[model samples]
Target: MKNLFFSREKIVQTFETLQGLIDGIRADGKIKNEEVIALKSWVKAHNYLEMRRPFNDIINIVKTAVSDHVLSEDEILDIKYVCKKFLDTYGGSKMGHLHGFASGIASDGELNEVEWKSLAKWIHTYDYLRGSWPYDEINALVHKHRSTLDLSSEEKEIIIYYFNDFCGLNKNSSLTHPLNEPNKPITGICAVCPDIEVYERTFCLTGESKKYSRDEITDKIFECGGIYKNDMSNLIDYLVVCSEGSPMWIYSCYGRKVEKAIAMRKAGHPIQIIHEFDLLDALEDAA
Candidate 1:
């Protein structure tokens, strides 16, 4: 609390504030009526509506937790996860953890074993101080250094997080494969549809392939005068779904980019999602 740098103090203060809020409701491991009333009052007081949708989602989850009159352990974890996610996504400095831990010792107005364990667990589990993850920077760093060399499990986790969080790409989006070139090919035509030139037509690809390697597929796309992208956007003309029925395939497919594509289609965009075989057939026809 003393001799602290101004910025570090601010981050610590913010962390403690959040910790206090969460602690207030979960003090007895059950949410009481008074706690629910207090939470509602806090929600009504904060103008987080102008912020991201997740903030509102946090509010809603609090309401749901209170609706049951008992907050389950799973609900507490969910709340914690969302709060951690919000902090990770938006802001907080990693260096402020020491102060937060120090202050959090007395967060529940005591340095008891339970409070200590909670502080330790929270400190270890969440990167509370590491404010504002540079998702774009991390993603760019990964892509710039990406290679055909198989990624280790940790590396894969990093890339997957980038796709899931930063790029908003789905699990179906192939990260193991080298990313396709963003630029259009110099020249080529699909023999099956030579009239419909693929050049400058942005295409987002998803799912794993069986017959052809991802690189081969990307090469064929480039050879067919198409622009290959890793995600679906209004700029995308096609979505090449390679495989289906993966555990979370449905959820990942309906992610932000695909939903955006759907909306764009409704607005008269000419985007189409085709299977890998369809793509292969087009290439074979051109060949």
Candidate 2:
């Protein structure tokens, strides 16, 4: 049963990656021959996922869409609809897709004028994400460099690093050389110390913690008269994001749960999203 659960999780993650790749290819508003080739290659590379429902469906759709070396508007819409249905069913977050889109656009290792403009347009289109972690940071970075004819090597590397970290792809090694200065601390984490409550309230966790295994965290929650849920929902009272980084995170420092919490909060649910440290403090206080 455990293995089956993990297998399903892997399939969903891969599907999200595919969505990101497709979004990246379309970012520039025009898909070139080479981009089509790249897309085909990506699908072929993930052919191992063919046994899964959506993968089987997506693989067939992509194969037919690009089989003739031409991607028509109808084909694009078909692919989009399939991906949308899967996301809607599985609760895929827009933030996750946004990070994937960033990773996709930068996968080629170059940011061109068209791609930059498209990225900016995307950020603007999702204005609701404005004050969230990484969104504001990314928005600023895109606008700051929009006027440049070509991004400097360092600038490009910074953007790439952001995308990699955001997409949980920065484990083991930096994608580029270490910067002389530290990268800015991620913003949009709750700026004020939240008054956290534990007893009888439901909690959902995202990202990874440097200090505790998930089981250990759940144990602590149980000990503190709190409940831990594996999925995010409107009933959750708090969404605890681990401050540490991990490759397992769908988004590096945060994940889909955080996005859902943000959306929930925006809708007036009073759900408090806090860092693991804040959770620790609350646990200690409860103790």
Candidate 3:
């Protein structure tokens, strides 16, 4: 009985590893020579003979993408469909699968865009809101086997934060500009000019940006010599509105921030509420 149970557990583990392998391959759209070597090498090293058929299927699919060295929309959709199909039959440990995939991609030094898409999809699919959050699970796993995994403190931190951002937890660290800042940009004194240089400009962002995350926008702001603040105050020089005129954005989002900025402006503060594109232009001009 003990042997039978252990055997079943091992099989499940194998499936999880397989899922991770597929994910790592799908990440970054095109499989790199290094990734192909890493995947095939890892499987062979582990002696996953039973998984050879399905593994080869995935490898073939990836190879189709590799010929062009770019993943098209159709190719991306096909890969996602194939991965889902495989998961349906051999669903094992979601956390194990994610870790496996993440580790495989990171093995090559940096996780790419395709890889992030794969991880984010799986993380959302297994969100703790339903079962276990991938971020928490990975962190726990690292803590349990930190030394065994040979994880550097920095590597562990990166993995944890990646999962957090992927899962939309947005947990702020020193790496991110904090949403809450004490120095509100004073308004009335500042000029509201479209031609204003981004350097030393104070910006308060509101509404959902379609193409940029808050962090990305903040990073751009810093790069352009601008300051990003989450709230509105007399000190804010510009309010970058990403989603204006949309009912959801106007009614359900940033209502308070918008109101406060308006009130400050009415009170003779010089805060100008501009569109996200305008902010981008300002950044480009400064660049």
TM-score of every model versus the real structure: 0.30, 0.49, 0.34
Model 1 lDDT per residue over 186-251, tens place = 110111111233666777777677787888888887887778887666778776656542211232
RMSD of each: 18.4, 10.8, 18.7
- Candidate 2 per-residue lDDT over residues 1-287, each given as its tens digit: 12233454555656666677678877777777766775676667666655665578888888888899987878988887887788778765466567667777775556778777878888888877754545544665665556436466766765666665545445532323345243422233442355688999898988768899988998999999999999988778878777574211223335457557756654456677666787888999997
The digit string of per-residue lDDT tens for model 3 on 1-287 reads 12222354455555565456556655665655555554554434444342355555655664565455554557645655776686677665565566456656554555444554555565456654221233333333333332323444444445544433321223342223232123321111112233455789899888778778889989999998889888677778887777633212232245567657655654446666556776877787787
Clash tally, candidates in order: 5, 0, 10
Q: Predict model 2's lDDT versus the native.
A: 0.67
Candidate 1 lDDT: 0.46
lDDT winner among the candidates? 2
- Poorly placed runs, candidate 1 (over 4 Å): 1-197, 244-249
lDDT of 1 at 249: 26
Candidate 3 TM-score over all chains jointly: 0.34
Candidates 1 and 3 compared: the better one by lDDT is 3
User: lDDT: which is higher, 2 or 3?
Assistant: 2
List where candidate 2 sits over 4 angstroms from the true fold. Answer: 1-3, 6-17, 64-72, 130-137, 157-287
Error of 1 at 109 (Å): 56
- Give the distance in Å from residue 16's predicted Cα in candidate 1 to where it truly belongs: 58
